[model samples]
Target: MARLRDLAKLIRTKNAGPFLLTLDIMFPDRRTYDRVVASGVIKKESMARFFSVDESKVRLFNYEPANAIKVTVPRLVTSGDPADTDLFGGQQFGPLVNVEVPDLPAA
Candidate 1:
């Protein structure tokens, strides 16, 4: 029942563009990376719910070389729009910091 933050080396968010926000979940090593990806712990459905975005619009990428997962989604509002709150998107990653990760059954 370990949390995602405890296993991830880095989980951060940033602005990909005026209309997109990007999230990065990096693992410290391959073992940890495999655990999250193989277990289906970080699926688009779950992520969509977490971010309040449409599943079809969410883009998830796993980079083996970096042992990292990247998620890109349209921002709630265009950057610098009247409704925009976080211009830098730097503080948006906090919600992912304590997400509980379910343990995969013995494989």
Candidate 2:
């Protein structure tokens, strides 16, 4: 097995807006992208669990051309709210980095 952090070229999170956070899973090549997408480990339900949001509130966009998957969820705390620890939502991607994925064949 391989961790998502190993398979993906870049995994990051940021504020889509004051009320939403976006996670970007970018793969280095088409082979890696295809493997990750087919793995089915990265989906709305999984993302919802990772961010602790309702499944219906997670929006996933697979941008094939860019070899990237984008997931957006409602922020647990509004940006700049007193309870918000990550003002830019940058620190919210921890859960996704360790997500397990089937190993890729050697290049």
Candidate 3:
């Protein structure tokens, strides 16, 4: 968790702009995931959509990815929550979360 915080701090200082961290989890484990969530390094809601998984089952904050990257801000397009599909009577998966790192901001 400290490492993640350090990484965020480093990126913030070096880039001086909004960044995106993509956490790709090949194998999902509970304990490791919980630790990340408790640390509050990344936003849970953002992560859930990033992985394209159920937010309820998978807590974004708790998730630890085998690989991650600090990139530039992305154009987020939120469709809706997965749980709302039943009510909407249509398959409405959450919006696609894409990250596009722009030029580093001036310090």
- Model 2, residue 32: distance off in Å is 0.3
Candidate 3 lDDT score relative to the true structure: 0.32
TM-score of 3: 0.23
Per-residue lDDT tens digits for candidate 2, residues 49-80, read 88899999999999999999999999999999
TM agreement with the true structure for every prediction: 0.92, 0.94, 0.23
Winner on TM-score (2 vs 3): 2
Q: Model 3, 15-90: lDDT tens per residue?
A: 1122222333222344433444444434545545644454553423222464232322221323233433233212
lDDT of each: 0.88, 0.92, 0.32
Best of the candidates, lDDT: 2
- List where candidate 2 sits over 4 angstroms from the true fold: 104-107
Judged by TM-score, which candidate is best?
A: 2
User: How do all the candidates rank in terms of lDDT, highest first?
Assistant: 2, 1, 3
Residue ranges of candidate 1 with Cα displaced over 4 Å: none
1-107, model 1: which lDDT tens digit per residue?
A: 88899999899899998988999999999988988898777889888888899999999999999999999988888889888889988788897877777776787
Q: For model 1, where is the 10-residue window of minimal lDDT?
A: 98-107
For residue 1, model 2's alpha carbon misses the true position, in angstroms, by 1.3
Candidate 3 deviation (Cα RMSD):
14.8
